[model samples]
Target: MRDLYSFIIWILSYQIITGQDPPREQYNISCHKVRETCMQDPSKSVPRCIENYMRRCSMIRTRTPVEGYYTRDMSDSRPMLETEEGIIVHISSEALQKSRTKEKMNSNLIVSLVNKTFFVTNSSPEVVYGDNVLGVWLGVKEISNLSEPVQLRFINSNQNENVSCVYWHLDQNGNGYWSTEGCSTNVTNNEFVCSCNHISFFAVLINPKIPEEIHIVRLNYISYVGSALSIVFTATVVIMFLCQRKKHSENSIIIHAQLAGSLFLLHVLFLCSVWFSDRSDQVCTTLGLLLHWCLLATFSWTAIEGFHLYLLLVRVFNIYFKRYMLKISLVAWGVPTVTVMICGIIGKYTSVYGKYAIHEEKEKSSNTSICWITTQTVISYITVNGYLGLVMLFNTVMLAVVLVKMHKLRSQDVQIKLNKKRLWKDWVSLLGLCCVLGVPWSLAFFTRVPLNLPVLYMFTVLNSFQGVFLFLWFLTLTCKARKEEFVPSKGTLNVSFQSTEEHITTNVVSNMIQKK
Candidate 1:
């Protein structure tokens, strides 16, 4: 009993040291075989196979036995048998060595063959003289897209003295599929004298590999170009706003220019910081969070603009200009600032921002790129886009109300009604400017799916054209400049158009000059 416990412990130790766990049944069967075979040759039994098994098991276990039971003389003397699915076979030293050698050479190969249902067998083990032979049974070669697996039966008829060993090989046609092929060898006892020789059968498999560089390159290129365009357009708008500030009246420049310029510039900086850098850095991660939050601020500002204009024209409510400006500015800037700060703090604590990048399975094109919030982060997304949508809706309604009220006022007044009508036209033009600049963009942004590089670039290009549209419209609206009032000082183009009296005065002057 003590010896049995020692043997089990040794086997376990060997398994641990070698990192090899052969089937537990293999050891159990060998032990059972030893017990049965011992009964047959009780007096001659130092059960050689059992001792050899213990030795192999012990090599992998915690402790090594100082002395072994099986003598070198008895190593080859024991006649052993193993059964594989009703096929009885002789187990010889050569067969054992063959199995060991194959395991040492390639571990995964045998496992792959096993997974493919390849069966290895011994070649005529019963007829040969203490011989070592490796053979296998294989399925027939399969051909065609819709056919069943081929079936083949293998038989081995060797002398009783020989050993049996088998392994399988797979033949691949370079495509993803494979066919089975059996490889085997036969060795004599004399071969065991110098070095124990063995044979094995195996199959080969090809793994699937994806080309990573192509995708990476495309994504990076899109990001770089999109980021560059966004930054450039934003910078240009900001610079134009700053440089042309003194040329415009103080009210027009400060109220419109500063807010618009700041929003545009901030959006540019946000885009560049979020998408331009490699996503592995902490800066990129934080920027991604921060940028989206600032984007919310921009949305809020758009609402502020719409609301302010609506209050001025629609007569739904009256607000002092100072109070309106302060309140709108505070709400627009403060909301995003606070939201972003909270997000940053949460991210610092949890190390996970509420955003991620998504890509398609076969996405190799830059045009297919988008970095957007997922449905899971829809709360934040809705807050930004929904606010813009509501503001736009309100602005549309307000514009309609203003048009109706101005028409009603014109119908009631007879004198200076033309002038009031002109003022109404100016308001309409202002509304047109807002619609052209803001409406299409808001529509695109609200309806678009997950944002990516191409979308970013497209949006930037569209928004960049906003300044041109505004400048052209403003210039066209102020087209009635008179020669007498042509006072161009510094960068300001201050000129007024002539009324009928001014025209008559100009003609009288011209007539006097002609007579002289």
Candidate 2:
């Protein structure tokens, strides 16, 4: 029992870092059967942990080999060597493959360790300057062991030539993959230098034989872009709000500012949860769903305003501000609140509702490292997006009708004999703002149907810019002090009351005169 416990503990500690059992020869007596033996031990935590790690790791490392055992020194750290001409970064294949185990490791797992040494002169550029910088890379392909071709792309931020730095295929053995031009290339000019700053790259293993080939796999680059845009958009909205504050009505200004601030906060929260924490947590998952709901609600409220104006102007209905004030509040606050709660509950019980691809990444992609929601069932994902699309569709149609009505009214009023046309101007401008901001964001609910980076980026860019239009037309274009010309007939009411009082007084005086 003691021996079993000790073995379980040892495996747990080792798996925590390298994330897998390396070579069977290193353990000698077969650590694969350790779980079976350790299950009989007094405690179950350590053995269970080992089992979980192995299950998760095996799903990811199917094609990629474990490092260290096949390549570089694994003693303490990798070696460092320097040269006057350029930098030398050495990574052995054996060490890499040795550490590749059947355990779930972090994306931050250093797949390859390098001995880097630079000895450039002081006057030389930073890329060539003397500094021993470790170049760490993830997902190094076992090029020598694969049949079809593979690529090892370098970081090319400058958009220079030599874009195809590494490309290779099997010679004949059908047992290996190789890099054609080795690893490093010398650059002549500073303009075309390859560095980690501006460019990011990935490797692709093409044409895997038969049923095991992983296709349609995507990376979490969308999450990266979404998060980045969220930050930038948040900042832009904040600046615009500050600049345009004096031009708006107090109520409209407050609501617009709150909307901007809320969006900024929501995105920031998402950014942190995405890049820093796990999306599987109850809090993070709920918050992520809430952010989306908030975005939908924001546009939904704007559409409501447009529809309300259309009813008042075209249908000739009284714009009783009191009657619809509560409705506006309900649509703005109630809908999103309910949605977020429902999503949270679903995420808690089933894996479908709040599992945003930004945070809840799959343990095993079964192919490429794609970051998407792996629901307990696929139908649930379809259902959620379907519902969102429908809601957005309804709002879009309603607003479109409102805009058309406003245009027609404007054309009709233009021909009529009126002085200022103030009503026409204000109402039309409001409708225009609604169309501009709400249309693009509404389009996003459908565009993200296929779920990809390009679409995601396109949507993000559009949605982010919506804040600008929102501030410009809705919040910054109107003045708070100006009263509308359409106030009820106060002068007519007062005159009628006075006339009735005078008639009563005259009747009383005539009665006295008759009595006299």
lDDT (C-alpha) at residue 187 in model 2: 42
Q: What's every prediction's RMSD, in angstroms? A: 23.1, 18.7
* Candidate 1 segments whose C-alpha is farther than 4 A from its true place: 1-252, 274-277, 316-318, 321-324, 349-355, 363-375, 405-432, 435-437, 445-464, 467-516
| Model 2 ranges with Cα > 4 A deviation | 1-265, 278-283, 299-303, 321-323, 352-384, 413-432, 435-437, 445-457, 479-516
lDDT of 2 at 263: 59
* Predicted structure 2, TM vs. truth: 0.40
Q: What lDDT is obtained when candidate 1 is compared to the true structure?
A: 0.39
Best by lDDT: 1
Per-residue lDDT for 416-477 in model 1, tens only? 25676656644656454463326545544522232333454555554544544444444443
Candidate 2, 431-452: lDDT as tens digits: 5445333555555444323233
lDDT of each: 0.39, 0.38
